[model samples]
Target: MSESYDVSYPGVRVWCRDESGSSSLVVWRSQWTPEVIRIETPTIYNRTVWTVGQARVLRDVLDAAVRCAGGGSW
Candidate 1:
């Protein structure tokens, strides 16, 4: 089985997917950051942020839910 979900709010977007026993989430945001690089004129630049480690952490949480709940560690 497989499932996917998407959530968007203002300048943020989150995508989650689960297939078989693997799950992950990808988060993206549009905002001004130091990582932005000028693409057009020197005064014009684009800002984008993509997070993957956060998604992996969330997936790990699910794998360790039992331990977090005071159950035996896996």
Candidate 2:
């Protein structure tokens, strides 16, 4: 099987990647952009997840899907 991440805009749609390897987002997609993000701050027991910015462009588009799905709000 294969996987995909379909990124898009109001009047535009783009597929950024097709095939790839897997690793922590910190390695590749680092430092965060306007996109919704999962920040795992190191803790004694586990990691804390969070969102960094409030971008109106794709506010509820990409990463927001996780938060809206009750996957820990930022």
Cα lDDT for residue 61, candidate 1: 87
Estimate the lDDT of model 2. 0.36
lDDT (tens digit, per residue) of candidate 2 on 1-74: 32343322211232233235332222112333434443332233333334444333344675578667777533
At residue 57, give the lDDT of candidate 1.
Answer: 63
TM-scores, each model vs. reference: 0.26, 0.22
Give residue 42's lDDT in candidate 1 (0 to 100). Answer: 17
Which lDDT tens digits does candidate 1 get at residues 1-74? 32453333232233334444443333333244423221111112323233556545655886698567886532
Q: Highest lDDT among the candidates is held by which one?
A: 1
Clashing pairs in 1: none
- By TM-score, how accurate is candidate 1? 0.26
| lDDT for position 72 in model 2 | 58
